[model samples]
Target chain A: AQTVTQSQPEMSVQEAETVTLSCTYDTSESDYYLFWYKQPPSRQMILVIRQEAYKQQNATENRFSVNFQKAAKSFSLKISDSQLGDAAMYFCAYIPNFGNEKLTFGTGTRLTIIP
Target chain B: DVKVTQSSRYLVKRTGEKVFLECVQDMDHENMFWYRQDPGLGLRLIYFSYDVKMKEKGDIPEGYSVSREKKERFSLILESASTNQTSMYLCASSLVTGGWYNEQFFGPGTRLTVL
Candidate 1:
C-alpha cells in the first residue's frame, strides 16, 4: 500500500513570485512514479510534472518543477514565476510499477495567486 | 492531445436511485480509472481497469462498481446513490508502458449530487 501526504492545505503566492507545495509519500516499492496534478476552477486535472524513482534528476515543466528526494520520500512541487492561472488545487500522486496503474493521491493543497 | 471525456459535468440524483457515469478516451490508452474527490480526502481510487474486462478494486470500492467493455470506454456504476457518495468523480486514462512510468490524463470531473 502507498500513501501520499501534502502538509499544506492552502497556499498563497504573489504573482511573479515563486511558491513551493510540500508532498511526502510512504511506499514500500523501490521503483515507482510520482506526479503532481493541478486542478483549476474549471475542474480539469492537468498534469504538472512527473518524476521517476530511478532517476535522481527532478522533473521540470515550463513553470513547474519538482524536488524529488528518494531517500526522504519527499517530492515537493515548485512553481516559479507564479501566474494568476496557477491558482488551483494541487494534488500529489503516486503509482507503483506493477499491478493496476491505480494512482494514490494526497489531500490537495489549494493555491491562491495574488496580484 | 490525449482527451478524456466524461458524460456529464454535473448530475443530480435522488437517494436509492441507480446512477451511471460514463467515460471515454480518444488516445486509445490501455488503462482507465475511477476516482472520487472530496474536499479534504483528495482523490480516492474506486476502481481501475488495465484492459477490457480486467478490473481491479482500489482503496475505496465498497460503494462503486466499474465496467470496461472497450479499450477506450469505462463506466462507473452506483447501485444506489447516497448522500455520502455525492462528490466530484474523475475519470483518467493512461498508456501502459509495461509499468508505472506512464502518465495519466484526466477528464473534467463529473460532479454528482445525491439528494
Candidate 2:
C-alpha cells in the first residue's frame, strides 16, 4: 500500500506571489507517479500537474511546478504568480505503475490568496 | 473534454437508510473510481471498476458497495448509512491507454449528510 502526506494543513499567499505546498509519500515500488490536484469551492477536482518517478526533471504546468525528490519521497507543489483563482484545497496524490488505477491522496492543504 | 457528472450535488439521508450515489462519465473511460473526502482525509478510495460489471474494493470499502451496469455509469451504495458516512463523495474516470500515467477526470462531487 502507498500513502501520501501533505504536511501543511493551510497556506496563504499574496496575489502575484509564490507559495509551495509540501507533500511526501511512502512507497516501495521503483516506478510510480505523483500528481497535484486542485479542488475549488465548486467541488470540481482539477489536475494541476503530474510527475513520473522515472523522470528526474520536475513537471511544470504554467504557474504550477513540483519539486519531486524521489529519494526522500517528497513531492512539493510550487505555485507562482498566484491569483485569487488559485485559492482552493490542493491535494497530493500517488499512483503505482501497475496492478491498479486507483489514486492515493494526501490530507490536502487549503491555500488562500490574499488580494 | 471529458465530463464526469454526479447525480446529486447534495444529499441528506437518515441513519440506517440505504443511500445511493450515482456517477456517469461521457468519455467512455475504461476505469471509474469512488472516493470519500473529509476535512483531514483528502480522498479515500471506496471502490473502483475497470470494466462493466467488474468492481474492486479499494482501501476503504467496509461500508460501501458499488455497481457498474453500464460502461459509462458507476454507482456507489451505502447499505446502511451512518453519521460517519457523511462526507463529500467524488467520482472520477480515466482511460487505460496512456500506460501507467493515465490521468483521471473528476466530477463536481456529492456532499452527503447522514443524520
Candidate 3:
C-alpha cells in the first residue's frame, strides 16, 4: 500500500512571501502521479498542482509549483507571492498509473497567511 | 465550470439513525468517490463507483454503503450512524480519458455530526 506523509502539520507565511510545504510517500511503482490539493475554510477542495513521475520537470501553475523528487520519494508544494487567499489546509495525494483510480492522501498541512 | 454539489453543508444526526448523503456532478464524469476528512487524518476514501450500480470499497468502507443509480448522482449511506462516523464528508468526480484518469473535482463537503 502507498502512504503519503506530510511532516508539517502547520505552516505560516507572511503576505507576498513564499512558503514550502513538505510531503513524502512510499510507493514501489515507477509510474504514478502526485498531486497537491487546497481546501479553504467552508470552501471546496481544489487541485493546486500535479506532477507525473515520468516527467523530470516539476509542475507549476500560477503561484503554485511542485518540487518532485522521484528518487527521494519526496513531493513538495511551493507557493510564491502568497496572499491571504492562500490560507487553507493543503493535502498531498498519490495515485498510480493503473488500477482503481483511488487517491491516497497525507494528513495535511494547515497554511496560514500572516498579514 | 465543473461542479460537484453535496446535499448539505452541515448535518446533525443521532446514534443508530440512518443517514444518507447525496452527491451530484454536472460534468457527466464516469467516476465518483466518497471520502471522509478528520482533523489529524486526511481524506480517506469510503467508497467509489465507476459506473451505474458498479461500486467498490475504498480504504474505509466499514459502516458505509453507496448507490449510483444515475450517472451524475452518487449517494452514501450510513446504516447505523455512530459518533465515530461524525466527520466531514467529501464527494468528488473525474473523467477517464483514453484509459487514463483526470484530476478530480471536489464538492464543498458536508460536515456530519453524530450525537
Candidate 4:
C-alpha cells in the first residue's frame, strides 16, 4: 500500500534551537512530490516547504529545509532556530506527478518549542 | 494570495443527521479536496474534485460524498453523521500543473462533533 510514515509523534526543542522531524513513504511510483505542512492551534494548516522527486537539490524555505533521500524513501524536515511560535503539528505528505491530485499524509509530529 | 475558506469552524450534530461542510477558493484553482484529520491516523482524504462537476474518491470515502457544481466551490456531505465520524475536516485547493509541485492551500479546519 502507498503510505507516509512519521516516526516521531511528539518532539520538543528549546527556543532558538533546532530540531528535525523524520518521515518515510512507501511507494513504487517514480515521479512524486513531498511536502511539509504546519498546523497551528488555530487549525490552519500551511505549507512549510515542498520537494520534487526529480530535483537533486533539496527544498528550503526561510528557516525550514528538507533532507530528502529518494533511495530510502525518506524525507525529513529540519527546522532551524526554532521559535515558540513554531510549536504546531507538522505533517509530511506525498503526491504523485499525475493529475489525480491525491495527497497521502503521515501521522503528524507535534513539535513543542520550550521557552 | 490564495485563499481557501470553509463554511464553518465548528459544528455539532446528532447521529444520523446530515452534515454539510462547504469550501470555497478564490485562486480559481482546478482541484479541491476534503480530508478528515484524526489524532493518530493523520489526514485521510475523503474526496477530491479536479474540475467543476468532477470528483474522485480519496483513501477514505465510505461515509462521505462530495459536490462540485461550481468551479470555486466544493462541498462534502455526510449522509448520516455517525459518532465515529467526529473529527476535524479540512478543505484544500490547488492549481492544475504538470510539474513536480502543485501546492495546495488549506482553510481553517472544521471540528465536527456527533453527539
**Among these predicted structures, which one has the highest lDDT?**
3
Candidate 2 regions exceeding 4 Å error are B97-101
Best-matching candidate per TM-score: 3
User: Over the stretch A9-100, how does candidate 3's per-residue lDDT look in tens digits?
Assistant: 99999999999999999999998899999999889999888888999999999999999999999999999999999999999998888866
Q: What is the DockQ of each candidate?
A: 0.64, 0.61, 0.62, 0.70
Clashing pairs in 3: none
lDDT of 1 by residue, A1-115 (tens): 6889999999999999999999999998998889899999976898888888999988999988999999999999999999999999999988887755567899999999999
| RMSD for each of the candidates | 1.3, 1.3, 1.2, 1.2
For B1-115, candidate 1 gives per-residue lDDT tens digits of 9999999999999999999999999998988989999999999889989889999898899988998889999999999999999999999998984364478899999999999
- Per-residue alpha-carbon lDDT of candidate 2 for residues B38-114, written as tens digits (9 for 90 to 100): 89878988999999999999889999999999999999999999999999999999997235547889999999999
Docking class of 2: medium
Model 2, native contacts kept: 0.59
Q: CA shift at A43, candidate 4, in angstroms?
A: 3.5
Native contacts present in candidate 4, fraction: 0.75
Worst 10 residues of 4 chain A by lDDT: A95-104
Q: Report the lDDT tens digits of candidate 4 across residue range B38-110.
A: 9999999899899899999988999899999999999999999999999999999988844554788999989
Candidate 3 vs candidate 4: which has greater TM-score?
A: 3
TM-score of 3: 0.97
Worst 10 residues of 2 chain B by lDDT: B95-104
Q: Residue B1 deviation, candidate 1, in Å?
A: 0.9
